[model samples]
Target: MVKKYRNFKEVGDAVVIYSDNYINDIEGEKLEDLCASYMERGFTSIVIDFSETDLVNSIGVSILIGIIEKVRDCKARIAFSGLKRVNYDIFSIVGLTKHIEIFDTEEDAVNGRVPQEMVTS
Candidate 1:
């Protein structure tokens, strides 16, 4: 069984996961597990919200890459939101932006990628 992360909310076919202040090895693993569990649960969209995240180390970046690949292989859409300027630049430099969407807010991320059929007026 996968260990679920508590700081997340479900919207239609999307799930918004809030990141901790720092995304190091442990936190990154937890985030990966959470995202994987959500994918298994059949969510079509997954957004990782970095509103509170202050930093992401190299280990975290490596794990994020794995998570991104898993999400893609599962045919799911993934997005990142609320990233700080530095984090944004880091992600861009690392080519993560090439694989996923980036949004300014959790709502924007969720609304932008959730399966259209799952949306309501």
Candidate 2:
């Protein structure tokens, strides 16, 4: 079974998924499935890049929660990068920040380094 989600690249032990411009239920589910598949294949680090993502609806956010849980259950690490400022603030306010680290660039996410200014306890 070959499934394709927007786009993705594997970096060493990490897999980076590039999200769609508009993340609705359909695209969100595709992202989830692709990430889950990679986890099943033994990817210990995952990064979902939102550089291209302009907006994500409520359903998309709900789906993201599921993906976050799945990553935890798989005992893998996950991060998000390239989020537009508004989207990043929305995610932070929605409490996704509690579960995942957000970065300004894919390189930072792949490197697993969140800028100090963005860090919050």
Report the Cα lDDT for candidate 2. 0.84
Error of 2 at 21 (Å): 0.6
Per-residue alpha-carbon lDDT of candidate 1 for residues 1-121, written as tens digits (9 for 90 to 100): 2224479888878888998999999999999999999899999888899999999888889998898888878878888999999898889889887657788998899888454432321
Residue 72 displacement (Å), model 2:
0.7
Pairs that clash in candidate 2: none
List candidate 2 stretches off by more than 4 Å: 1-6, 113-121
Measured by TM-score, how close is model 2 to the native structure?
Answer: 0.85
Against the true structure, whose lDDT is highest? 1
Per-prediction CA RMSD (Å): 5.7, 4.9
In the predicted model 1, the residue pairs found to clash are none
